[model samples]
Target: MTTGFETDRISRRKAIWREIPAGIWALGFVSLLMDVSSEMIHALLPVYMVTVLGTSALTVGMIEGVAEATASITKMFSGALSDWLGKRKLLAALGYGLAAFTKPIFPLAPSVGWLIAARFIDRIGKGIRGAPRDALVADISPAHLRGASFGLRQSLDTIGAFFGPLLAIALMWLTANQFSAVFWIAVIPGFLSFVLILVAVREPKRPEGLRRIRMPFSRSELGRLGAAYWWVVAVAAVFTLARFSEAFLVLRAQSIGLPLMLVPAVLVIMNIAYAISAYPVGVLSDRIDRVTVLIVGLFLLLAADLLLAFAPGAIGLVLGVVLWGLHMGFTQGLLATLIADAAPAELRGTAFGMFNLVTGLALLIASVTAGALWDATGPQGTFLAGAVFTLLTLIGLLPVQTRLGKREAS
Candidate 1:
């Protein structure tokens, strides 16, 4: 039933898959395992905090914001260290190890303070690994396959994201809705992730004639990142303002009369859409203008926000979640790819660090604002605010579209 054109297309896709480095695949798997471990706890944490601990939505938002901000700040330093030491894998392994060890604390925490501390420490580990791991992927992948590589890694990570929730849902059913028991089981995968990264990932050798940089964050070194890179960061920070944390998604689902045991299904559904769309979108961006693709992603987010704000019933909620995931798939890897394309190889770690720093801070502001809105005006206001921000981001992208296109052509 396959035509010649279809056969050629299939062969091309196979060739692209084969062209990705083994190390990238290893890194992807590493991400997959860690996300699996993290999401299992996170999918349940918001509801647990609200219901079991008697925390307010505002408190949950504050905790999530602070946790993420801490991670972002840590990334800046850890990323610089990775650049100075020229050993991404060592820092990466150390990060994952720290996270893995911290997993038990989630189940053991007796109070909100202890839970906050655990989440804080866990995010620090995430921060430590994030930039270096991304830089490692950029280093390993050929320039031509950069989009595909990041997409593949993101798809793999999201697969774990969905799987984690599914496992949590299943465990909740089996354990009679015992949250602590599910958290305990989540510890196993975290350790597995740490071990896999330590053993499986092979760092590429540094290129000849590549000078070792002593100060990745020095003024002169930062100047080397250029206007193009900063523009990408600025746009990304603004875009992040529209997205907020996924915790809100869980809250929204619960608000609609979804049972406690099925709450994790919200993440399960969104991540499934995210996992499915990421790779194909990445490939499409590789062949077209990345900025155009990003603009489309913005539109998707806008649509999601509108639907989440005004859509009726369970079907509407599910549709909005899918759109949210699709937007993530279209944009997340592309942003990383943009950073890799813009920054000098020597400064990649620093570039990613700085980029995340700005966006993470933006997310903090957005989450806090969203929580306040949710408390004062309900979920409708929170999501409508998101839609407004999404529109602003779309407008902001106008000036930079030509520049991004020229960069892609170059």
Candidate 2:
């Protein structure tokens, strides 16, 4: 059944896969395990907060926004430290270790305050490790395979994201909907993730002529990142305003009469689509214009927002979730690839840190606004607002799309 062209294509794809560095693969798996641990708790946390703790939708949004913003803020400093020390793995290990230790708190927390503190501490760990880990991937990857590398890591991480929810769903069923019991089981994978990264990931040696920077965030050092890099950050911040936290997706599903036990299925479906599309889209970007791919992603999100806003019944909800996942697959890794392409190697950590900082802050604003809209005009308003933002982002991309292509070609 296989034609010669098909055979050639398959062989080439395998060759590209083999070309990716072992260190990138190790990093991907490390992300996989951590995401598995994190998602298991997160998949249930929103519903638990709303139902068990009597928290409002607005409150949930605030908590999620604060948690992510904290992580992003921390990334800036941790990223700079990694650059200054010229050591990424140690900081990465510390971050993962801190997150691992925080896992028990989720099950043990007796009040909303305690749960908030746990989430806060957990995000700090995520923040500490995020930039350095991303920078490490960029360092290990071949320039030609950069898109594929980030895509592969994202794909692996999303696999864990879906798996975590599936595990939570199963445990909920077996334990008779015992939320604490499921949280307790989630702790094991978090520790495993920490251990895997500590042992398996090896930092590449610094290049012979590379100089260590004492102040990565100083005016002069930041200037080195250039207009092209800053443009990527600006466009990314606009794009982030369209996409809020995944917690809203859970709420949407629950609003439609999905049973509590099956709520995690929302993430399961979205992540499957995300996991399936991410690597292929990444590989596609390697061959085409990345900005074009990103534009396509924006369209997908627009469609998803429209569907989530106006579509009828369970089928509509599932379809919208799938499109949302696909959009994430198309855009997320490519954005990282863009950053890696634009920035000089020496400042990659700082570049990623700044990018995360901007996007993270944007996300906080979006989440809080979405929550307020949910309270005022219902879920429809929240999603329609997302659609409007997505359109604005599409318009914003017009001026930069050609420039992004030119920059990547250079």
Candidate 3:
């Protein structure tokens, strides 16, 4: 016989699960498989480039920055096309397929140029899927469960993020640190992700009354997105600037005397924290004030930046990485939910495209800057710059935070 409290808790869990559409669950697993594929390679790429290929830190940074920017830029077109076609799953599958094909390239790269080309194509696939996939999630989800839905996807994604690194660590040991063998194993999951998406994901039918617009980017259509969506975009771009690429985190772990084989543990630890917290934070956002949650995330990033900047040993390094994960857990899903909340459903693909585009460009700049700073002043300087930018972002958020409070109060 369950106690009253236990029964109530069990019922609530069931209710939340019931609210999320099957498509979302399918999408979550698709993301989980894809992350597993990507992370296995990414967990080790930075070190592979630097130690094996003899690429400089700045060069590594530039590669990562460009790779991410390529993905972001691609989303603008893919997302707009999804809106025009009123079909998301096809484009999403195409993107995943492209990425799946690119997985083999990672193991074959004999030079930095080849590596760059492979990464570029892989990111292109990511760009193609990102906006439409997000918009689709928004489309399928009920309004009340929006936060939980995004959180669920993010949590599943982070599960891959951690698992990828864990596999890399295991393979490293098994192969006596043979990088190419692990890269080869990663290819399996990439194709699996594409198959899962095709079989499992069901896009919501276009609303019967929707005016199918040919020009998703026309000024009038853009105007329909309104001020609220743009505000979220601006703040997210600044946040992107503050955070830069996680490649730096891998490098940071290496800097603190972390062994080459053990470095994936940094991502493993961070993603564990991320996977655990994302759903809970999402549930919290649905219940309380979201801006407050965003602020909390920003502060966590601040702490992470500061900790990474001044940490004296391995313990400090791990702590900083955990804080970084916590910040990601708190804010990433919330931002997606906010975009869904702010945008008109018909224009959601465009809304997400524009949002990702701006932030993606910001990421490009931030990564380059971080790399340049590392070249000039070492790792400390890179993280210190991040701390300053995070502080600025907090100050910038004050007005937004105030308005959120007033709106709720009224």
- Measured against the true structure, the TM-scores of the candidates, in listed sequence, are 0.91, 0.91, 0.88
- Candidate 2 lDDT, tens digit per residue, 1-410? 99999999999999989999998898899888888899889989999998998989898878987898789899999888999999899989999998999999988988889889999999999999999999999999988899999999999998998898788888999999999999999999899999999888999999999977889989999999877888888888888988998779989998889898677678789999999999999899989888889999999999999999989888999999999999999999999999988888889999989999999889888888898999999899999999988888888777667666676677
lDDT by residue (1-410, candidate 1, tens digit) is 99999999999999999988888888888888888899889979998988998989999978987887889999988888889998899988888998999889988988888888889989999999999999998999998889999999999999998898888888999999999999999999899989998788889999988778898888999998877888889889888989998879989988888888677678778888999999888888788877899999999999999998899878889999999999999999999998998888888999989988999899988988998999999889999999999898888777667666666578
List model 3 lDDT by residue over 324-357, tens digit each: 9999999899988888887788888888899889
Clashing residue pairs in all predictions, respectively, total: 0, 0, 0
> Model 1: C-alpha RMSD to truth?
2.6
**Model 1 misplacement above 4 A:** 45-63, 107-117, 177-181, 254-263, 406-410
Highest lDDT: which candidate? 2
- Provide the global lDDT of candidate 2 against the true structure: 0.90
lDDT of 1: 0.89
Candidate 2 residue runs with Cα over 4 Å from true position: 45-63, 107-116, 177-181, 254-262, 406-410
The local distance difference test score of each candidate is 0.89, 0.90, 0.89
